[model samples]
Target: MPVTDITTDAENLTMTLVADVAAPVDRLWRAFTQPAQLERFWGPPGWPATFTRFDFTPGGRAQYAMSSPQGEKSRGTWEFIAIDEGRSFEVLDAFADENGEPMEQFPAMRMLFSFETTENGSRLTNVTYFTSAEGLEQVIAMGAIEGSRLAMGQLDAVVQDLRAYAQGQGTRVELLDDTHVRITRFIDGPRELVWRAHHETELLKKWMLGPDGWTMTVAEPATDVGGTFRYAWEQEGAPETAFGFEGELLQLDAPRREVTTERMSGVEGPGTVNDLQLYEEDGATLLTLLIEYPDKETRDTVLATGMADGMEDSYARLEAEVLSK
Candidate 1:
């Protein structure tokens, strides 16, 4: 729990959050400035954030969305108002619609983020100023304070050394809820190349084969939102051992993030929504896939089939065959 205090001033129409982080001031600053790092902790727990556009300069803007386990998305925007290099910054924050435009029904606020060194590590001061007391009350009623605390509680993981934290860890899966699972793998490659490996048919065909005996037969990838992608695999020397998945692309942000609806080739009804994100730091990329299944039974059935091990095998091949060279 990094947060020390969360206070509200009704008269001033402001809310302040103070936290002590066990990281250097510079490291703390980097976590806030970098979109990848910020995304890791910007949303509370099961509702993870994805930043599609981030411009870290005065007069610039950022657009992001927090997705709930049930596939509900709450969008937000930030307009950079001022900056003091690595020490502090200010922005106008507001709720946004699906198109990234601010929603007039929700209250907008001015936020100031200040960083300073402390004896143990660093201190972060986040103050949000609302236009009116009712505006502040409205946000508070929406669970802003508790949500912010839970969100900041995750900052410690972001500030630590990425390689030290995840390099040796194989494909790891964590059940976020009954229907959502988050899978992560650290790839020893830059973000762009990793993204290319996922999007390019030639590159994907070389390494996406799950196990040694399997081979990719189809690799038609979706090129735009609403477009569908198909992939199939067959066992070597065994044509009958064929399986595939097809999905429609929902969102795309090159070299960073994409969301798709995945389903087995023949099976229909409803399928999982796969949200893939790539974040790079110090020449290494962390790939995260958040999969939303229709029910717990479906999630369990998929995981019970040794999915993590299969993913690990594919990721290892990806590094050895495509990224290493």
Candidate 2:
């Protein structure tokens, strides 16, 4: 019960997820069959989904769009193949285009979800069977396992939250994101402490690294508007590597925010401006960073290369630094 079990058959390319809810079979079935109820927790944590057409009968189709917490949206459709009231349901699932048309690149798969009543409550199991090994492999390669786990975890939380709300608990984090991630966290520390962690050479050594086996050789920051800042890292027993940025400090509000317009070398063709804003909040500080690229292709490439995770990790490190000090 409570998503306490999951099994995957790599050979058969099938995944089975089981969850137990304290609600009765009828109530659970309603949560599954009702479009409004389904939309409340159909997506991974942080994503708010909306269903367009949900006609539960066999041969009917259900179309929906899930909007990520960060604003990216994806569409999908499910054609109901079989439905046994309060027992089981099967569907053909596939991705849909922005205009709600099914996409050719995404293959349709069969999904069966079953609801069984028990003395404790209800057991819900979802079985996904792919059409071909290639299809299964493609889904697996796209991190489906982790995504499913995240979604299921969210579902569990949603169930508990719903139960609590029914018994009179207040609001909760109803929205979630499945893609297009950006990390914006507030740190509970002094502004000077936060600034020192980011600008100090000793702390920079603990974070920014050029490459494997490389070490930071230079980190110099001038505390003025027309000041200069340089950072260079080199590997042991190898030629030195460096990246330089020269710019004018457009604005420096001290202990609060700083803005700089600089021409960065070795990263595109120069004339790149990075805007970094810092503000005091909740007895600490909040930092927002926006790096403007010359073109959309570069931005897309950066996202594909795991920029979200990297930035999140960097912020986590920043948080640790602030706490440690």
Candidate 3:
């Protein structure tokens, strides 16, 4: 999984996404080409996609439907223009009817997908071009940016599972105690990369926030004993709801371990001391997070906030944007 970037350009009538997935180029290419895997993560979180037709050669076509929980379905098609196996492809994209025909009422566009190998994994650069600025605005106004983010977020889990199977181990998370939780994961990088991501403001902003619609408005990191840092965020449309976490560095052992006491604002709770341990494991980094709450009740309360899923998403994004970099 990489940091999924979704942005639109009004002047150029283009939408682009640049992601770094911590998987081999061949694996990602296969996932895109194979109908079965493609359907698993082709749509946003709540919608599951089904491909009725898939042709993988140049000048081929793909037709699929994304069905929502309410039983409503959205159909789409891709008319492949050119293809270079395991490298890149270009296609014409348009809304389609359930019967495999274009929906003339909807807009159509062109998309180009390219893959480049990185030091640790692969990078995908996807650019969608619209025929006119009005067409671009039509899709964007219809929630294209949000939908693209949700769809790409789904890709993180799929690629991570594939990598875990090949690694001989999977990520483990546990409730170690009534007032503590533990998370251990095999990060596909050296310990230094993971450590830098945790300690640097620039790297933290890349993937630290749990999901889309939130931006890191403030980031100040000082990884020294007794030093303090402030990290804050604001929702896309809710400035009044902006919140953050401020903490003091209690212990600092570069690339290995860190200890801190943090107070989270914008949410209810007292300060908690956290300890993180990182080490090399089978050519990868194994990160262990020990969370300590002020009381058992607070720990239970925090757990009920769906923090586990948020943390999982963060770690996956860390791989996509930070570790692979």
lDDT of each: 0.91, 0.64, 0.77
Q: How close is every model to the real structure, measured as TM-score?
A: 0.76, 0.51, 0.52
Winner by TM-score: 1
- Sort the candidates on lDDT, descending order: 1, 3, 2
lDDT of 3 by residue, 10-98 (tens): 89989998888888888778777788777756886435577988997787899998864334679999999999988999988999986
Model 2 agreement with the true structure over 1-325: per-residue lDDT tens digits? 1667767777897878887877678877887888866765576544446798998889999999876423467788999999998899999989998877679998988999999998988888999998788888887887676666655654543344322422222111111232222223455566677777667888877655533455667766557866766666566666544445555565454664455555544555644345454545345554544455456665566557654554555555655644565
Candidate 2 backbone collisions, by pair? 2-20, 46-175, 46-176, 46-177, 47-176, 47-177
Q: Which structure among the candidates has the greatest lDDT?
A: 1
Tell me the tens digit of each residue's lDDT in model 1 across 92-175: 999999999999998779999999999999999999999998899899999998899878977876888879879989998988
Worst-scoring 10-residue span by lDDT in model 3: 162-171
Candidate 1 stretches greater than 4 Å from native: 1-20, 33-92, 96-104, 110-120, 125-137, 140-157, 237-240
Q: Evaluate model 1: give its lDDT.
A: 0.91
Where is model 2 more than 4 Å wrong at Cα? 156-325
TM-score of model 3 vs. true structure: 0.52
